[model samples]
Target: MNASEGLWSHLTGGALFWLTLTLVVYTIVDRLSLLARRNPLANPVLHSVWVIGTILVVSGTPYETYFDGAYFIHFLLGPATVALALPLYENRRVVLRSLVPIVAALAVGSAATIGSVIVCAAIFDLPAMITISSLPKSATSGVAMGISQSVGGDASLTAIIVVATGIAGAVMATPLLNFLRITDRRARGFALGLAAHGVGTARAFQVHPLTGTFAGVGMSLNGLLTAVLVPLAASLIGG
Candidate 1:
């Protein structure tokens, strides 16, 4: 409406604010990665997202406008998810042999993921949105957001929590696994991805390609299961 607002919006690509920030942040993260020690916790995607989010908040840019530009990046998520199939194929025999355990683990893990969040929220008397947001922290962003929304959570918050949880899992999984004496590649991979999603899969790849393959398998399947289960779980709880 005002000249300052008009000029700022125009210069900022109006609704595409998030897109510009995403690119800029990603570029910075890429350079930093090359110029420093390669740390899994310093993940480019996670770091870029944080930088972009911080700037948007500081600038008072509405999340809706930022999401407009950010939505373009989301389109790639579908293809990237599908591409995980290649890794899965590379480990097909092991996958088949371990299908039962994987499914069982995923089922129990999914329940734990949602249950722990909900129980903690109840114990702390957290608001409904925060409680629901944590329910999908172990899922991929797209599926997690859907599940969050279905359960009366704010999808954007769910996205942030999902990313944060994945990063934390990626960072700590190796040491934790070692402590637990869980050295089997397939089991480690499955557990990490089931609990941590994409970041865990990326960390798994750092150790071995086979581990990455199984991690990818766990991440993709769990995402699907979480999407369906979250809503159903909410309904049952509410009922």
Candidate 2:
């Protein structure tokens, strides 16, 4: 093989290459988002996914290979999710004052999100497994996957749906909220989190700290609720 081709193969075959590529791609897209004044279309996660997916496809790289290099980041996800609590703790007083509304919204929002998915699946005549898998789509991936498996759905499909839901929510939330003329940051963030999960919470943080805090609260509570609700709903439906 030629010297350049040999070097390329050597680099691409290593774990460090994929890890570096993931970080660099994300950083570049994040900077572009900032340069674009944080436009929703310039969302870093969306762009990163596009760019990285393109590269993997073009290079004929297996996802498992890419993930091997990037597994450390996956390992850190649990800790990162836990760190979301710090913001909630700092804003405890404000959150506590809105406890009643938060609880009410969580119940209504969780049910609506899950119910809508189930209804849509039924309307489309989708398999029962698909409906069960999608029931926890609004929850974060880890929790969503567990709920999906416990309820006899495909965990991998649930993870994919959870990610798609989050990305769609993160991208459309600002525009949707503005179109509705909803000026309340807390409301916006909570809705985003409840509907979108981690990606939505990240988008909320980009807009405002208060919004991010509420979004985190919503995401956390929704995760817990989905765990219980999905199993109960599955039983009710005889799934």
Candidate 3:
């Protein structure tokens, strides 16, 4: 093989290559997002997904191969999620003060999200599996997947739907909040996290620390609530 071809093959054969590529792509996209003044439309995760997806497709790399190299990053997700507790703890006073409203919002938001999915699925006559899979779409992917499986839904499909839901929520949140003239950061962050999960929490962090903390609170609480609610909702919907 030619030197260039040899080098390319060597690079793709190792775990470091995919891991580095993922990090570099995310870093570059994140920098671009900053350059864009942190515009909601310039969401780093959304753009990074597109870029990495295109690269994988163009290079004809199988997802299993890429994931083999990038699994370390996936492993970090657990720690990263746990780390959210730091912010929540740091803002304990604010969070405690808002406990009543937070609980109220979580209940209403979780119900609305699941109920709407069921209603739309029934209206469109979607399959039982698809409807059940969608019930946890508003939760974080790992939690959502478990909820989907427990409810006899497709876990993999639930992950995809969760990501889609998060991206859509992140992209729309800022503009929608601005349109509504909702100036309260707490409300905005909580709403974003409730609807969008982790992606929305990340977006909230970009705006303000307090916002991020509240978003994290919203996301965590919603996950727990969804875990309990989805199965009951699934049974009612005949999942």
- Residue-level lDDT of model 2, residues 12-74, one tens digit each, is 888999999999999999999999988888888889988999999999988889888988776
lDDT score at residue 128, model 1, on the 0-100 scale = 71
Q: Give residue 29's error in model 2 in angstroms.
A: 0.4
Candidate 3: residue 102 lDDT (0-100): 96
Q: Output the lDDT of residue 151, model 2.
A: 84
lDDT of 2 at 108: 99
Report the lDDT tens digits of candidate 3 across residue range 1-239: 89999999888878889999999999999999999999989999899888998999999888888888888987776677788899999999999999999999999999999999988998999998899999998888878888888988898789888988998999999889999999999999999998999999999999999889999999989989999999899888783
Global fold similarity of model 2 (TM-score): 0.94
Least accurate 10 contiguous residues by lDDT in model 2: 72-81
lDDT score at residue 86, model 1, on the 0-100 scale? 88
- Candidate 1, superposed: residue stretches over 4 Å from native: 1-9, 14-20, 34-37
Ten-residue segment with the worst summed lDDT in candidate 3? 73-82
lDDT of 1: 0.82
User: Superposing every Cα of model 2 onto the true structure, what RMSD results?
Assistant: 1.5
How do all models score by TM-score?
A: 0.85, 0.94, 0.94
Better TM-score candidate (1, 3):
3
